[model samples]
Target: MTNMMIYNELTAICGENNVFIDEPMSHHTLTKIGGKADVFVTPQTYEQVADVVRLNANYHLPFMLLGNGSNMIVKDGGVRGLVMYMSHLSSVRVEGTQLTAQGGAGIIHAAQIALEHSLTGLEFACGIPGSVGGAMVMNAGAYGGEVKDVIDHVKAVTPTGDLVILNKEDLALDYRTSIIGKKHYIVLEAVFKLEKGDAAEIKEKMADLTYRRESKQPLEYPSVGSVFKRPPGYFAGKLIQDSGLQGKGVGGAEVSTKHAGFIVNKNNATAADYIATIDMVRETVKQTFGVELELEAKIVGEDLTETAD
Candidate 1:
């Protein structure tokens, strides 16, 4: 299918206002880096998302599902085909002690809702910037709490554009990964189970976690949160610090001085610079401790042929 034909079809479905051509990815990601996407799509409903997925399949065009782009880095060469942003679908509701949230709802927003209802389980996610769907896909967690602990089930559209409900057990949530992510399913909504708790205590706990995050993380700079996953026996940040890689940088990308786990855009950094900085840290850590540091932040799109600074 030709580009014009696909564009016309997508416009017919979501309207021209929802579709963008050559959209800059830098504007979407937290790192403020990356090139452009050939086609950017924003679907406001679950049916729209399913339709978009089916359209991409029919056109033989590849598509990427994106949330708020918190833990992802798009490369300098950008992305081909469709890049769907799900933020417009955000909606949250509560019933009794259960909370159901649309995929695009921010984790922080969901946590706040839980707080308002005196729900106790989601306080740990109060500081997460990712959408609830993204958190479910990655089993995102912090402060000794994980999404898997409270997730009751999730509704998602498969890559083939079929919507299905999966229980928490079927999700196979582990440290930073899930069946949804592995299968490239587009999450529509998630149901979380929580207990009624003292609102005051929940607020206090959320406040403490937020303070720790802000004080330890390089929140002032643009970054994709933690760059590397925690190795089995050691923390990524401590290892990087031990390797003498603190404050090291390539171009405008720097290993955060405040926290070695983060690679921050201290200056106006390119995607290439961020990638190079990650590589440098990985290699240094590998040589110093004989540990292969895997990345927590997923890299997507294409790379540009440019000299690294």
Candidate 2:
């Protein structure tokens, strides 16, 4: 089938307004640097999401799932197939001591709900900028807490378009990674088991974490949070700082002066600029300390240089 046929089919499943062609990836990401996606669709319901997946599978079309777009980088040549945004599926509710949240719900909202219910466990997530599904896929955590520590189960749609529920163990969650990250599973919802606590204490803890994040992170510019994973026994930021790489850049992308961990779009940066800056940082760090740095962000789409040739 041609791209138009796929677009028509998607429009039929989701309303015409929910489907877009040649959508700019920059508009969807936190870094505000990317090319375009050939197709973009937002499904209002879980069934609609599953149906899209099924249709894509049937057509042998390549598709990618996106959450809050916090930790993603789309290349300059753009994504070839469909990019499904789950933002429309956001919903959150509480059941006793458990918080059940839809995949598209902002992860911080779960912490807010926990605060409302005087739940103690989710205070650590009060400042994470990603969606619940993204958090589950990456085992996102902060201030000594991780998603795996609280998540009881996760519901997702497999690549084959089957909806399946996975317990905590089945997720195979680790530091900044999970089985979902490795597989073609689209997270639908997550259930977190929390404990009742004093609302005042929970609020205080959340406030402190929020303050710390604001004070330390370079939130003034566009960035995908931390760029590199913490290398064992060493911090990525500290290494960059010590290497005198802070305030350095490639094109419009710069190593944040306020926080060495972040690569910000200080000027009008392209995805290629960000990639180049990242390469520079990794190479410099490797040359200086002999430590290989690994990216924490998910980079997708095509390389413009390769495509141009």
Candidate 3:
């Protein structure tokens, strides 16, 4: 099938206004550094999302799902095939102690809703910058709390566009990984089982966590949150700081002076620059500390060199 045919089909599924060709990924990602996507579609409803996915499967075209884009970096050459932006699906509701959020809903917003309902479990997620779906994929955690602790179940679409409900046990959520990504499941919604607490206490806890995050993280500059995962027996930030790599970087991407764990876009930086800086940090840390640093943030798309070819 031709590109025009694919565009028309997608437009039929998600409306003409929701579909775009050669959309800039930099405008969507948190790092503000990426190339364009071949095609982008924003499906407003669950049925539309499933239809788009089914169409991609039928066409044998590559498909990628994007949530808040908080912990990801896309390469300069951009992504091929279809990119589904899920922001339109965002919705949150509270019933008693259960808080249910759509996949595209901001995790921070979910925490705020929890606070409003005097729920306590989501206080730790008040500072997380990703969407609920993204958070569920990585089992996002902070300050000794993780999404697995509160998630009751998840509704996800299989790669073939069939929807299924996965209980907490089925999720198999670990430190920063989950079965969802491994199985290529698209999260539709999540039910969080929270406990009732005092509204004042929940608010205070969120405030404290927000303060700590602002004070410690380099939030002024655009970044993909923490770059590397914590190695066994040591924190990644401490290792980088101790290795004298705090102020070093490649291109406009610099290891944050405020937080050694983050590589920030201090100026106009390309995805290539950001990736190179990540490589530099990993190599230096491995050489200095003899520990292999694993990536916590995800890197996607293609490089400029590849696109040129």
On lDDT, the leading prediction is 3
Q: Listing every candidate in turn, what is its Cα RMSD in Å to the true structure after a full C-alpha superposition?
A: 2.1, 1.1, 0.8
Clashing pairs in 3: none
* Tens digits of lDDT, candidate 3, 29-78: 99998899999999999999899989999998978899999999999999
Q: Backbone clashes per model, in order? A: 0, 0, 0
Each prediction's whole-model lDDT (CA): 0.92, 0.93, 0.94
Tens digit of per-residue lDDT, candidate 1, span 17-128:
9998889999999999888888998988888899999988877787888898999999998888889999898999999999999999999999999999999999999999
How high a TM-score does candidate 1 get?
0.97
Per-model TM-score versus the true fold: 0.97, 0.98, 0.99
Model 3 local distance difference test score:
0.94
By summed lDDT, which 10 consecutive residues of candidate 3 come out lowest? 1-10
Model 2 C-alpha lDDT versus the unseen true structure: 0.93
Which residue ranges in model 2 land beyond 4 Å of their true spot? 306-309
Most accurate candidate by TM-score: 3
Query: Using TM-score as the measure, what is the rank order of every candidate, best first?
Result: 3, 2, 1
